[model samples]
Target: MHILLVEDDHKAARLLARGLEEEGFAVTVAHTAAEASSHAHAMWRFDMAILDWMLPAKDGVALCAEWRQAQHQLPVLMLTARDAVADRIVGLNTGADDYLTKPFAFDELLARIRALLRRAVRAQHGILQVADLTLDPATRAVNRAGERLDLTPKEYAILELLMRHTGAVVTRQQLAEHVWHADLIAIDNLMDVHLKNLRRKVDPAGLPTLITTVRGRGFLLAQPEGGDA
Candidate 1:
């Protein structure tokens, strides 16, 4: 999973990021709210955020509130030294999904993160469809025109993301971050190859092409005009 970790303590942030990375998470550390905001609004999509309650200008509570106000559903776990009951309530009320007090155990943090992710997945559970293409997140299955399409892991990830945002453009940067967990510049050629292969299979002969490339923007998956199957 991709995580945006916002903490002002440089040493603490580095240690936490290293630990999360060791646990197989892609971590982006931000030392300030501005940096965190930039990363949050960038083309990269973060699955969750670990925010320190006491940040330099804008605190984590305020930042979390801002994200909620903007309709961003990114799960937030607030870390703070305040152990008061009222403080915890305030953090939750400010839009944090979970709270971790300072000097926390790494294992506990990891467990909470897993639990939050599980809840998120359950919330999004359902069959996804765009035009004639269908994908079952539970089964990792894909089908079109009554026939199942065999797909590689990478191809399936790309398609799932596109299907989830049907009718909207998904930028290459977003795809790379979510799928490959790498920068777009490093995986540009590799991405093109996978995209081409995916298109060939998903858009075969005698069927309307569902995936289209918007030059200088990204890829779009949508039903053709007239909505023919």
Candidate 2:
């Protein structure tokens, strides 16, 4: 998964990046709020964001608010030195999915990241579909136009997010949020490559496209009536 880290501590940022990389996650580091803002705006889609409370210009809470204002639904985990109940409440209220205080065990941080991903992956509402595409959360099966579609973990997650929303628009940021677990790898054209691969696997020629781009908006997968083209 791709991650965007908004921490100013150089040593800590590099250290965390190394460890997370070992865990098979792609991570990107942002030292300040301005960097994070610019990075995210540049279509460097992140699955998750790790934000530090203290930054040069704006605090993590303010940056979190800014991301939300931009409709970035990616789960953000706030890492801060403050360890007060009120501070934790404020962090959560500010759109942080979880909080990790300084001097934290990296293991706990990793566990929290996994927990957040588990929450995102589940289908409390069960099956989701769009047109000929169908995803059975219980079976982990996907099918389209009477033909089954094979997907990797990341592809399945992407498709699941789209099917869950069906005809509703899902932006790249939203997709990143729903699919990204912990680390976001910078310098990788991961999302672009994956989307292209998914399209190829799911749609061959002459098939009324199931996954269609909404231009500047995002993407939508509409459920066709009775699987009709």
Candidate 3:
């Protein structure tokens, strides 16, 4: 998922952005509200926004209100040092879906973000199952035939995307754009290498290959019969 992170403190923003990226989110960092507004104006597709209440020009509350006024439905999580009930209420009134105070634990922030994403994805966030393979997006868990699978962040992202579009061919461009940000160009065979590694981990010994390559087109996730996938 792509995230818009608005934080004014350089140190704090750097730490938080690194943490989010390590957790498998594509994050765009903006140190000021104007930068955040520019990103929004560019029509960047973001799954969620993490905004700091304190800013140079426009505060997070105002930015969130502006987003609401602009009919942007992206979930917003407000971060502030103000932990008072009234302050939180004001933040919520400004259209923030969740709140996290300063000095908060990274784990808690991760949980809140995941919760908001799940809420936004209503039907899309649940446990996805296909041919004895199961994936729980909420917990980032994947299991096949009751056996747990340990997958890297990139592998997990690719698997989840394919699972989301079961039986459909997911183009290389699509995968590249989502997995690696638009600014980063996907090198030749990068996708193939990751998919190959994912296939090896997901389809164990004596199991049918679940990922099907369509030569020059893309990949499809389906149970193939009596043939190599």
Candidate 4:
């Protein structure tokens, strides 16, 4: 649901971003390769990236190459003016997952985005159900032992994200990007509030806290004290 748009044409980029935003996507636009490079170097998290093949400093391919070198397996979608089979093949073989030519429809663009996101997500994209726990992405549902656990949308989102990245320490920024809306992004107590709420919901019995709050870093999902249930 988040994307990085690397296009030199500000107008075109704005229009594309607007369309994607309307469809409930968080978009960050980088008008120059330098800007994209800065973001990439800063470790800005994006579920997917859309790059213009024709760019200054470094073309899309070059930028993508750099990203791949640093952090491979990033889902990149390339946009170009050329429409040759060779060009598309080169783009894909380089690092891009999908390619869209100039004058492409917004619908197709959205579809491609979804497709790339889907492919990148693989087995880790959708709802997660383990034992009595039920985490549903679409409905934002969470249940334990067939008992429905009431959680606000934000709480549910955070819990689902934690489950998806179970056993790993998910930084606060990562949770912010995925669970919080743009308006709430500036809220200082965003993570603390939602996570405290989620803990109550998931650990009412004091059975064992699966959402472990790692001091100073972020959080992890597993039984409390690293003990087996």
What C-alpha lDDT does candidate 1 achieve relative to the native structure?
A: 0.90
Q: Which stretches of candidate 4 lie over 4 Å from their true place?
A: 41-44, 123-153, 164-169, 181-185, 215-217
How far out, in Å, is residue 47 in model 3?
6.2
lDDT of 1 by residue, 32-140 (tens): 9888888645523778899999999999999999888978887789999999999999999999999999899999999999988777766775888877889987678
The candidate with the higher lDDT, 1 or 2, is: 1
Name the weakest run of 10 consecutive residues (lDDT summed) in model 4: 179-188
lDDT of 3 by residue, 11-126 (tens): 99999899998998888899998899887654335788999999998899998999999988889999999999999999999899999998899999999999898887774557
Instruction: Return the lDDT, model 1, position 84.
Output: 99
Q: Give the distance in Å from residue 102's predicted Cα in candidate 4 to where it truly belongs.
A: 1.0
What is the C-alpha local distance difference test score of candidate 3? Answer: 0.86
Candidate 3: residue 132 lDDT (0-100): 79
When summed lDDT is taken over every stretch of 10 residues in candidate 1, the lowest stretch is 38-47
Residue 92's lDDT in candidate 4: 86
Name the candidate that leads on TM-score. 1
Per-candidate total of colliding backbone pairs: 0, 10, 0, 0
Residues 1-229 of candidate 2 have per-residue lDDT tens digits of 6778888999999999999989988788889998888875543356678899999978999999888888888888999999999999999998899999998999998999877766654624666656666788767898877888889998888887787677799887676555664333541367767888888877778777777788887777775445643
Which ten residues in a row are the worst by lDDT in model 3? 179-188
Question: What does the lDDT read for residue 163 in candidate 1?
Answer: 90
Model 4 Cα lDDT, one tens digit per residue, 70-173: 87566899999989999999898888888999889888998899888777666355768644577866555688767789888678767777787777898887
Ranking by TM-score: 1, 4, 2, 3
Q: Please report, in order, the local distance difference test score of every candidate based on alpha carbons.
A: 0.90, 0.80, 0.86, 0.79
Give the C-alpha lDDT of model 2. 0.80
Rank ordering of all candidates by lDDT, starting from the highest: 1, 3, 2, 4
> Candidate 2 — which residues are off by over 4 angstroms?
42-44, 123-128, 136-140, 145-148, 153-229
